[model samples]
Target chain A: MGVVMAVPRHVACVMDGNGRWAALRSLPRTAGHEAAEAAVMDVIEAARSSGVTWLSLYAFSTENWRRPAVEVDVLMRLVRRAIRKHAPVLHARGVRCRFLGMSDPRIPAPLVRDVADLMTLTRDNRRMTLTVAFDHGGRRDIVEAARSLIRSALPADQVTEASFAEHLPYSDTPDVDLVIRTSGEQRISNFMLWQVAYAEWIFPQVLWPDFRATHFRECLDAYRRRRRRFGDVGRTATTTGEGPR
Target chain B: MSRTTPQESADVFGPDSILRRLVGQARWALPVVRATLLEAAHPQIGAALMEHSTFLTHPWRRLRNTATSARRILDPDPRVRDREVVRLNRLHARMSGTDAQGRPYDATDRDARAWVVATLFESTVTMCRLGGEVLDADAMRRLYDEHRTFLALIDGGSDRLPATLPEFWPYYDHVVEHRLENNEAVGVILYRLLADVPAPPALRARPELWVMGRSVAGPLATAIIVASLPESFSRRVALPDLPGARTLMRSTYLAAALATRYLPESLTRVETFMGLAGAGADPWASVRRQAGKAAALVRLLTPAAEDDGETVRSADRFFAEVLDQTGDGYLRWPDLAAMAREVATRLDLGEHDEERLFQAYAAWWRELQTALDGDGDGRVTRHEYAAAAASLPGSGLIKVADVLFDVTDADDDGAIDADEYHNLFRTAFQRDLADGGGTSYSRGAFVRQFVSFMSGQQHSSAYASLLSQA
Candidate 1:
């Protein structure tokens, strides 16, 4: 008999090392991004099938605009193409798509429209929600939330953590339970600061382009093996729920 | 016994001192978690942290704040350092709370602060020794003495911490062996270090370098922390262990020491000299200040229609007379939903169109509540509604208007006709009026509401005329 494991409700991924993967293969960075399409689809299918309710992918960061203009152009086009290609598949699988942090003017209008269309098409999907954080910066999101609150003319004393959280983008999105940053580079790089405050993290050493469903499942297994205490004492035989300190 | 002069105080960690020589190297950060664990092991410190700190929710942030405070204290500029001392004192003054056992804990307590300083001093030596950058007995003693002086600066008085290297060890050992509690704080940190070790944000962009070092960094740091713990301490607490962890630590720290020797200061030091470039100084502070000034100037030059008292009143009246169909003092989701249903009924719309109108109103309510619902009571007061309405011209709520228009304009036309507009007003002013049976509002009222919704133009006369019609 096997012990039942508690699966995380929401899992977020920072898909890193695409450029590094391309460099390793002596191919253009675009090739690595192109290859990541398979990994994204695979992860989505895996998460949907494995009973995960919410999955967020770090598709592009605000700082990614600092890359060479040519590469940025290619990435924007590639992302649009990927969205167009995956919309039907995602909708059919009942995966609701939401684009977070889409405030950047550099994002093409047509791509924005396409994203809106995708969101509307998948609006009623209840199986899973796939939030793609494009042009997102955690710091920027926080600043925007603050700005929005100020514009609302809310009294200072009335602002609580719960109220402040409601001002953030996708306020309905639940806190992330697990954050997997591929390529074994263990930096958060300003992704979802408020959401991932207490999230467990996994760095898998594999570049995102090469990540597969097996790796995803392995990470989920690792998550189950670990215990989450959230500041309280854990349940152990040697120690009562309350200890000396 | 005598007070040290300013010159004498400056001599601690001064030029040619071993403490200064070893302090800021990037590799020193390796034992930071270990030092933190040691500090938390002290019962008072652990109890205080558990009571007052957001350590569980924001562990790295807590660590960063500590680092920032330390950096400011160690800043070469006297003004910066002194300012930080004052800040630290002020901050510690308020950090008093009770632990789970109802024992009061004060962060400013001498023994707890002393224990914190002790861990820092001991961890520095351990970090140096493990990495093969050996410090002699004299250097260790000198460093310990320097740390005592450092403590005096922070404590704002003579050092009450253990005065000498010999005295410090027994004090440290006794606490580690006996007094240290097998608490959850240490367990959580150790678990995090082993399972979710994150690189500092400073190293975020250096993926290749981090990847090369990550395999060793997390496990090695955990191993060092575990190994550094005394057998009694480890036994008392459920300290985690790794197979061959010590071997891994030895090899990696040796390589790291070699790298430190060969690498440039930029690669080896986490922080450089204190100046404008220091981490304590935000590089964008000046830019942000200038931008703020520019924004203020723009506001000054722009039209003041948005801030007009009449505009606020107009919005207030609209909330009371239009959206508050229940004649209640507060507007809630049901009011908005009912308004949408009324508009659908007035138009004699199909079920699908009715649902669309309801969804639009819900979306609008969500946007408004997300922005303006300060107390989050699920009800928007007339004042809150009016305040939000005053700023509606260019805000995201304006986008909500577009959504509402799209849903309500069922004919696929770009605009709503007078009949459609009347339907909206009829739903809005559904509350029983004293005059009764006269639902038709003047064209001035219609134009005024339209301008507020579409163009957001504020006119006192228009509002007065609209109020007369209402």
Candidate 2:
């Protein structure tokens, strides 16, 4: 059967199971982190090539600070190195780079400078936007947004869902159409608090380090196969409005 | 069985009417789920639900709301019934949306509205049949006519509905075969029904009992739902073939038949309609009082006489179904050990958690043996085990509840929030039935209500009211 495939406008990836992947290989967790840089670059390249307008990656949660200091240190170092390596290639490809939650002061000043420089360097590159959520919490984002709104002295009655959404960071990012969480875990882990109201989630069993462009394309195909209702009646035919009963 | 006269049939709420009798059955819940599924199978209705309804998220609340709406429409007072119908019509009138294919759907569409009512008539009939109430052709015709009358009362249009039972069959079959789509909504509803039925909170507190009930009733409910669907539709939907499904369906039919035939209406019928059906005496209270008197007499006759309580009978059944995994008609050490392992596995516990569960179960078993092993045979008979059930909850058995509760309290905040509680059941039994989403309260209070329900401290009606609100 011939079928038309629809491409998702915004796709997010919850890069999970790195620890498990590393443990499985009997390597230090840093090895898994190092391996994941290839998957990240592959997904970004594949998504842009596939006509996706926006892509977000969940790199670290706000709760990751609770992890042992050594693992956290390794992750911080790995992220800075990956950014330095990929910044020029990403800018050349016309991809806008963004860092979502670098509010914590523990992040090294030099690494922060490197990230800010990349963001400024790619500010005008609009072929696609890549949002990396580092030390991010979905609930905390909402709370911070609410604080911003309160600080603005906006009237309570005027705070519609749309208006409240405007106060959120990166408000231009459209609602996520597809979320791919690798390694088969189903929990949201607080990714994209305000934007994924009706996102279609695909949890593939492959670990983050092993997830490739083929798997990414497979997820896209799966997303096409799904019928997104968006809290309305499913459109089943070519028939338009028949008007009143 | 006595035949209903036309005069009695006209009054659908009359005690002897088929509508009254069928709606009164506690098994009415079966038809409600089936009817909801069938309605959602319609592409337009399913779309409207996605847009305007929370059926996907809060189905338990939706079911209770649907039941409430039905009860209001069937209220004994004409004014109340008319008012409810008007309110419903207004609510439905406001619902309009575009489908995925961009086909505009007005919820007030006559055919769609009529189909909704038709599903109720058809599903209730199927429910009655599956529940062992014989609905022959004549009875079906009578019921159909009454339903038509009901439709006219609610929608003020019976013209869109089939006029006769024979006509209804063709119309129903055509819709089932041609119009119904195995859409996303239908798939979700069916999947949740079959795979996600959670044990009630009381059962959750008792892991072994939860498994026992889950193993049987979960599959049985799913079987009845799949069996009730026409074979062509079932095949078209590509529902998985359940092993022993035929046997389960037949067993359900036979059990329902016997219950309807032998059990008093008070036991067989739903509690909501008891007073409206003009019940004379409170049968539950009367039974309780008589049981109390009998227990007193037994105590006077013999100082060593045991309670022989309802709890004990329940325990007796639990002993057989859950604790006695070997099915040797005795409770042995191996049985307790197996139960501990089963509970741990069902809960998806790690080795450390499993060991804790094992220790608790072993302690409880030793307590049972010390108190109830009359013959010193290193085994407890059903009677001896049951005799100690009255006191079992206070013994080491409570540790099991504690373990289950602790496992459920995900954050270890000493209180299981709604999500944690729901997650526990979804983790253990694939899904949960207690629509804890709508209610905001600690799990402790919910468990207490369930306990009161099981021990019969709270009246069935009271428990039902609490559950419906929950």
Candidate 3:
């Protein structure tokens, strides 16, 4: 079937395999995270060129809690160092930086400084938005949304698939259209909850540090091949036919 | 020989200088050099009468060269002009104060650095919050630069924060549209990105299932999550278009930009909201400088609480439904996750409570679907209730009689009862404030006197005020 080049308005990626990527090169795992951070600048610029308004990257997950505390601490410090170093480029380009994750009480104290510091520094950027999903869990997001609604006193029958989305953690962002998980991982690993219900998923073999914008484009190309069906008939199904996949 | 002069050295450096020259050729650099000195105290600021033992002036070209080199490599953006100003103030503070990082001679200098941090955070946050209204990237970058520079004040003085946060106090304000680095815990970013997956719209009526989305959806869900707690009317106004205003758009956008370059401490919400704000600086320490980070509790004049601590729940479920519906729209706004985090801080809500509130929030959504899913011919649709079922909030809210509800003759043909309005009105006056904080009717010192006129009087009066403002 013929496909439409429907690039996602909002694109999200899981920057995975930093440790493995570093180890494979006979380097410290910390090097991998650093490399991945360095790589972010190029990809970000590329994304802007492509006109993607919102880019969400999976930097850390709630499940990552199982790792050794020291490694985590190192990563947190690296994040600060990278931000301190790369922030000028981001600011000049007009890119706004924030993240998706558990609120402060859930995240540790040492890292909170960098988080808070970064948030305050770049509050007025406009070129593009980059959201880092750190220490985030999908199920927790849904539950939180549900809880928010109950406190508001909404009635029983009024609840719908659409009603609940209003309360989720990312309620302020748009629905995701495509998601790319790096480091050869085939799994989605619990990311966006309500926002990416119908998002197309792609798993690339390259680790986050090595993944380039061209690779990102390839993923978008793959997403472009599918016929999205929002539990309804595809547009082609009803019409004379742009055909089907 | 390197254009180093003893006189200039005496002017800028502390008393411990090992070497000094008589004079040199590049002494013309004083204009720029003098500005830096002015920024710091004249070894003394406005009100101060005393002088420090270590105070001294030093060479300008070398420091200027260092600053230029640093900005060239680490800070190439002009948008962060406020950051430059803050850095200048901080250095100024350190020069005047005794306890700067390098100054061993003067450790007793009153902590002026704290004020610099505090002001920097407040000004930057306010600037970003307001600039986000237009969704201008340039403006956002500028504010973010200011945020980052203020962070140098004293990140290690973490102990200076409020010894302890207030118990049971709700948080609602926070920075937004930025990304924070998680260097310490390699994988750990910030608390802003906690959820495993994005929360999706749930099936109507069964709101309890929402709590389990992470576990329930698992690998099938995208592996990124973020949320916002509740924010107030003022935040919404910060953007444009709400009642169509964009001011209330998204915090993630604001947080993300700033996170990449924020007042480092403010983005993360350390021991206190942030350490640098210098909120409790000595009253005597004052500087004529630009406002830094501007953090303030959102002030709203809500309805007054009753004398009996009874809150009158509004019978306008329709308005509540609209609020819920509008909230759903929040999911699609630009940087909502950061906005959610901001709301959490603004509300001072715990993640657990935020989750519960969301559950309650989802449960309350039931009434909206029923209204929206009407027949094409305008026939009303009704959801059945057993009547004997318990009315606990967690279970589900019952759409009962509003004071102005129209009860139809269901006996003749299963219609609503007209007296439901009076029942709803009565119920409004007799609501139970389940949360321990206080009765829904109890107004914390925050409520203004003028708004108190309509408390417990008429629901329409509150609506009238809102409408009048709109």
Candidate 4:
């Protein structure tokens, strides 16, 4: 009999090496971006089937804006097209779509509008949540939460970790339990810092465009084998019981 | 013989020392289990286990607790070792109960104590043998002597322990033949311990290997147990002596030891084991120190009560009420001195307990001189103290309010609200506050005191002054 695997409740993926993948193929960078769409879809399907409630895709980082203006513009356009093309499929699959990160003025107005509309349309989907982080930075998110707390006029003594967490955008999603960073990047890259304090990390060598359902499953299997101690001295979960509360 | 200094004693049990290497190796697991089973076979110990242990309900936790205690006993820190001695003493004091056959059992009984010591000696030898690290006659004698010294330190006396390794063998043989039994409780606990063995990572990665691993684990564990047992005891337990089981067990342990020698220290050394071992440069000590600092910060920020109604008492009322319990409503020097000594002892100041108590008394004396010694003659009569102490104002007891505000503010915005205070207190002091009562804080009282203290309008009352100075 196959051993039962403990799937993480939330999985965050840092899709990396698209540019490197394109360079290696002697193809335009846009091809790498285009190919990543299929990988994203495959992972989403895999995660949903594997009982992962939340999947976050690091599609665009706040630091990416500092790249060539043309690349940044093309990336923004590609993001909008991906949202428009995938929204119907995501909705049909009972997947909720949400965008995380700063709502900066630099992002084109039409793309922002489409993101909001797609989120609102799939707001009720409960099977799984697919969060696409555009222009996101973990430090920025923390700073924004602090600003929100200050603006709320809540009493200082009453503010707590839970209360401050509520101020973060998309506060309904739980902490990321497993983070898969493709392209062999070991560092977190300042993504979901507060939410992934004890999350198991898998740094797969495959580029984002080459990642598939099988690779995603392999990452899940790897995560299942991790003994997440959370700064304590034992395995966080057993094979047959709920994990540590 | 000259008295051994703490450093010299620590050197004998250091991380790289043979004793630690033997005890910490993965090959010792089977032998440790064998020892545990043997110890439980004693009727008094079995009765104690039946009464006091929760091995049936929380087997893993019970096992981990036992391992932690063992680690503490072997810890390098004199303070930690002394604390474990006290803890074991208290535990031994409580281990008295009637057996299943209506015979009264006591772990402190002469026979039971001897059996316990024998189990220890037997386990050490068995572990060395199984690990393929055979000790010669002199080495065996030295190991036994060291253990005897340890037994004396923890158990208070070694009168019941055998005088030498040669003498111990007969006692061990007699116990294995006459005293050891296949008690149902012991069997069940042994089964649980074996069943919970974590699968090797290579096997865990493959479904077929995982199943195969599970299927073989039971017999392999049983064979290890059988191999470690003496011939007569194996016959008594109905475990037929397989022709090559002993050799197989030794070879398996030897291979494991070889693998461990080649693997990275980080992978080979169990982090929990290392942390509990209290060896050189404990990482958990830093974690614990940070936790303690965080707890102190939380306590500083959290108000004593959750509502304005009962949170704040008139300074005079609080002093009078608290002092009345100390003695007769008036604070006395002798009472303060006694309180200081008690606090020092409770805090485990170790050999410096008297020094700490003296410091506490001196600090309180200084505070008293500043607040109530109006004559400046270094002594204040009761009339002089009572007259001067009435006007003393009460401030928040702990002084880290500003630092706590900065830490909890989250945004570094200068002004902190009730939410920041509540969250910081909960996160930093969850364990302490859980034991204190609940996490709720009196926002009104906290804010009032904090604001007054910050603005320099609040002063330390006599009671607050004494505690703060201490």
Docking class of 3: incorrect
TM-score of each: 0.41, 0.38, 0.36, 0.43
Point out where model 4 deviates above 4 Å: A1-129, A132-245, B1-17, B108-110, B190-212, B260-262, B272-470
- Model 2: how far is B328 from its true place, Å? 47
Candidates arranged by lDDT, highest first: 2, 1, 4, 3
lDDT of 1 by residue, B342-430 (tens): 34433545545555666666777787788777789978887776666655544333444554455545555554544554444322332
- Rank all candidate structures by their TM-score, best first, as comma-separated numbers: 4, 1, 2, 3
Over the stretch A32-72, how does candidate 1's per-residue lDDT look in tens digits?
99889999999999999999999999999989999989899
Higher-scoring candidate on TM-score, 2 or 4: 4
The interface RMSD values of the models, given in order, are 21.4, 32.7, 13.1, 22.7
Candidate 3 chain B weakest lDDT stretch, 10 residues: B292-301
Query: For candidate 2, lDDT tens digit of each residue in A164-220?
Result: 887677778888878999999998898987787777788999999999999999999
> What C-alpha lDDT do the candidate models reach, one value each?
0.66, 0.67, 0.40, 0.61
What candidate 3 gets wrong by more than 4 Å, as runs, is A1-5, A102-110, A227-245, B1-470
Please give the interface root mean square deviation for model 3, in Å: 13.1
Model 1 earns a TM-score of 0.41
TM-score of 2: 0.38
Supply the DockQ value of model 1.
0.01
Candidate 1 has an lDDT of 0.66
DockQ of each: 0.01, 0.00, 0.02, 0.02
